[model samples]
Target: MYSSPEQGGLLLSSLCLLSSLLLNTPLCYGGKILVYPVEGSHWVNMKVLIEELYDRGHNITVVRTSTSPYIAEKSPMYTSITIQNDIVFHDFFDSFIEMQIKAQREGASALTFLKLTKDFLSMIGEAHYLSCKVVSQMLDDKEQVKRLQEAEYDLLLTDPAITVGLVLARYLNLPVVLNVRWIASGEGHFAIAPSPLSYIPVSGSGFTDKMTFIQRIQNMLFKSIIMFQQNFVVGPIYEAMCTKYFKDGCDIISLLQEADIWLMRSDFVFDFPRPTMPNVVYIGGFQCKPAQPLPADLEEFVQGAGEHGVVIMSLGTLVNKLPADMTDQIASVFAKLPQKVIWRHLGKPPSTLGNNTLLVNWMPQKDLLGHPQTRAFVAHGGTNGIQEAIYHGTPVLGIPLFFDQYDNLLRLQERGAAKILELAKVNGPSFEQALNQVLTQTSYRENIQRLSSLHRDQPIKPMDSALFWLEYVIRHRGASHLRTSANRMPWYSYHSVDVFLLLLAAGGSVLLTTGLLIRFFWRTCQNSKNKIKKH
Candidate 1:
């Protein structure tokens, strides 16, 4: 008897299902995912990825603090455990703003910038310790530990900057995926990614990918300084916290090495070429989307400029305050521009505010960038702002302040999409010239637009690529096969420096022995010739 086509299709489908089950493949089957995001704007990036996962039918539990309240409580697939009595990050942010403004006022030189950066990083290390302490207290509670243990989470997702998640994963013996929200920092030493000082500029080095001999030397020194900070400064703080919390004498470095994947917030289109392992996934622009409609007032202000267009100026959330003199200088430039200006100002408005300038506490930044009338972007060179500007093909006049801002702008300048205006030298003429150059020059717009196309022309959206990798890790149980052997090797061994030294020693010994034999033979011949002369 002939089987019907429906029966044949059903039989084939059953066979495939049975084969998958027999092989014990997880097949992206959804499971519990626990996420611990770093506080502040960093959360904005993490929220997008988490929501995507939740939409895919995965149960997600986010651990947040009072400082970062759960905003997705309405979602059925998402829940949060808020840690009360936590140190609000806003205080730290305010202190940071004070430090930055003070540095700017003091006319910080390169040396001063390095000093300030070291101090800032040191302060962050202390805060990381405090955050870990609070989380440890909660985790140490017997009831809480029992609840977490019973939860049986299949995967742990967290930002590498926050060590509490690493600690929790260790405590519960779960696999982890680290989401790094900025350019790769700390020399990639801990991450086992190849960071050649010859090309890869350190986070705050203020150097582009193409370096002169002296710049390469400077880059190497900066890398050494970064390593020192990570090991001597940040390492100890994390170690102490991990030891106290887990009581297992765990090292944070080891935990980082064992992470299943690293979702970096960087794209190769904007960054220089560098070697990366399979575990490193570039997910830049994951938070970026097609711009939404602007508010009515914003639309009117932008559209009202006609052909002159408008300029959007923002220095990001962390820098809520600016020095008065600098503000005046900026305002003076804006006043002369025919273009309408939308500035994201903080504290008090500048006395020099002009009729063409519109100052608001907050504006729709991405939407404005995407608007056709946006002639230029004046940014502090934060990664998010730079990425958004690039995504929307807007040219930028970058006034970098601290941390990675210099490096970020340097990369954009190298790509012909931006120009860096030193904050200390923000005069009206220079600012106007720089803004005019970007707005009038066809090259800047063309270059940035080209990059925007490259950024957007991906096989899959960055968010989807990230989600696929996340599920791939879950399906394969930590995906240990993707990890490189270099991750487990010593620094010297990984770089083959030990082998080089061994070869050098062997060659030196052989050369020394050959020299000695030649001298001995020469001495013997001289002695025989002297004896012959005496006879």
Candidate 2:
């Protein structure tokens, strides 16, 4: 293959470009990465992402708990560090679930804000303690820690909700990438992004961006309550863990601030306008894909609904086992609907399962939502479910249970893509009316489709964007340049309220001193005049 002068030059240039690409590309392509996802939906949500990374030639090792056992097929590049503490993890989650069920049974209205706040704090504290304990146990095995350190992972990817992930990152001295599965909560403000409470609603505030004056006031109050709760309940656990595991004088907050990137599982389309640092990437809909062909049975069921379409009723994994009464009420509503109903029920099947309804232990939620025949979804307003619904342009009938579900449902309602069905007020009639409204109203469909378009209007797929950032961090050794100065600043200093207060204090002092001097001079002149007149 002898080439002419120009051809030879072109070949040489091509070779040079190839060499540059290979040399300049991120080192993470074949690097080892550790992922520590929290239990339940967090693990489920992370599965696709981790698999994608593995497909891209990255070495991934996950730390799996018993409750969140890794069920995904493993390849040479993908491995996991299974921590067997099934008893402890199960007991903790079971107790928490029992408490939630008890609260729901007591009626949502019966649980006052204070009680809810207290319960929420208690749960947070308990979860944190348990997580810390798990990490401690993991580290207690000196050989395990030695093996991990020996591996020299390129980066640490973890769920920010799990403080143990943060602790592990510190222990390994690795660059961190936080993978949060929800909108920025109060804890997120401390760990990931700066979500000002003035406009940004707290996780459970149930207030939208378009708030009334009173609602904003309530939001601020809720923010204060959350701050107090975080400090009082969660702070001690984190501190103790850091003190015990990390070196002396290690500040957990400062350690967390070192996080190089945050991959939040939310998009602006579904969230209020809030400030985010460069490193905070929105990978919403990363798990969403075009509708896959449903299973034979599910396909048959959905296809049978010609005109009335189908409605998916699921309370997500956490609330799959609903109370009998609640399930019966839901079933009763489904009985009246002309549309076919597919409810994800795990507990005792409702006795009133209508002819049109299919009660299954699990449903292909994303596929169902994307189906042309899917009319609406009844969900617990979980982040995963909501994102899938929005991705598929399906309107929702949200039965928010607790936590961020309430806020998420409120946002969807404000966007006109969903309606709320309060648990306390959930009855056959109300459920039927809400379902009928969503199915009959063209606006709900139109609004959700609009949002879906906006969500999908990005230049690249969200998964690609996430992978690029993850690799970018590794290529650069860390994406510290993307971090904001805000994370380093104290909360008061970040808001600059301290500076404003100082200025206000100085101005007030100047005004007060001037007024006092003027009064003193006036009184002295009056006394002198009186003395002159007497003389």
Candidate 3:
């Protein structure tokens, strides 16, 4: 109120400077993003990113197959472009899970495991073939291709689990951001990162980062399964499509490795400490949040447990239910537990079902995990579920069914945060025993709570980090500066086999020339000695 003229002028100048700085910064007028997501539980996490992007004012268009299971055609989050295609998610996985259950129930043999691997590979091959067909068909329609080209998308968001997304991103000439954990061949890191077999375990090898000599040999053999899938099963399908679509053919691995950014589905907390690249943004529990209020009835049910608390279980979206006998056995074990149990079971109600257990077709899994009254989680070890459990500090009693489930749970077991009960090992007593161990043992909760603290102790939230990097790509047009040129290098050059051979040849030549010079000098000395003797 009592400012002098000089002070008033100074204040006016500061205001002008602040206004100019604000104007010069430039605002982001939200971008148009094209998303081609993998269905099922993969969709669960990818949808979180899409939702956040929408909130940030970006326009999202999703590519969906008519037969897609998890990704619906209509949603407020995105406008979908549907392509008619073959069965991709549910039927294939359901039948495969059924086969595994039957074989294991009868006692799994070596051949049974082999046959399981073959069937699993076949299912993957067919999924890739069908998705490639979807993209190929879209490309065949000149009008659709012209429309997509005109859209001028800022970048493509996709999961490389479906190889067609990589091919489509290439054909459309869009900068890609992959929501990737699994590619068609194997785990995503094997394609894009430096994964040394000596320390980094292969996908299904049943070995940790610390390995003995025999384990290392076994790890190499397990790695061959990935190579087999890439070279023989999924590779040919995508290679043929690439040849027909692009004049210079492409392979899926190279296409994937060339992405603008990778929103890796895991962090070092959940994964082994292996080598990663600059482009990989760890958004392991990006979908997780603090618990919201539970429904009245569910809360009431949970409250009924009082001091005992509750235990929650889900087999994830892939498998509907376990074998009936196993289901009954699990039900019987739940009957004996003091805590109330809520299980997501799709099969017929077990004959041994008890009054204490509540069976639901679906449950708010993350919310339940975050609930204070919830004690332990019985999960099938999907990446999404595992990450949520880690975020909520929920110790898991894992029932690993198939795919990477065992590997995901293995990490928890090593950390002392979980205990694995194989399908083969799930009798009434064993089920009850494992559940009791996770619930009663203090170490399980303590260890997971510690992991939770470590995971949450980040400079920035994972979702925000993911969004910043994605928009970083959009702002820069592509993140080529961050991506390595190794993606384009040949196998020999990428692995430095050429450099090794060059050094070896140079040393070999030098040694040979030196040997020749020594031999000639000796011969000359002998001739001189003979001449002197004759003289």
- Top TM-score hit: 3
Question: Per-residue lDDT for 298-397 in model 1, tens only?
Answer: 8988889999999999998777778887788789889988999999998888888999999999888889999999988999987788889889999999
Clashing pairs in 2: none
Question: Residues 1-535, candidate 3, lDDT per residue (tens digit)?
Answer: 5279999888989999999999997466799999988888889898999999999999999999898878889999789999987655688778988888787777878898799899989998988887887888999999999999999999999998887887888999999999988888778888878889999999888788999999999999889988999999999998899999999898878788779899998999999998888888898899999999999999999999999999999999888878788899999999888899999999799999888899999999999999999999999999999999999999999988888899999999999999999888889998988999999999999999999999999999999889998898888889988887777788999989999999999999899889899989999999999999999
Candidate 2 Cα misplacement greater than 4 A, ranges? 1-28, 66-77, 86-95, 101-111, 181-192, 490-535
lDDT of 2 by residue, 84-115 (tens): 66534445555665676667656656345467
Cα lDDT over the full model 2: 0.80
Q: How well does model 3 score by local distance difference test?
A: 0.90
Q: Whose lDDT is greatest here?
A: 3
Task: Decide which is better by TM-score, 2 or 3.
Answer: 3
lDDT of 1 at 78: 77
2 versus 3: better lDDT goes to: 3
TM-score per candidate, chains pooled: 0.86, 0.87, 0.95
Residue pairs clashing, model 1: none
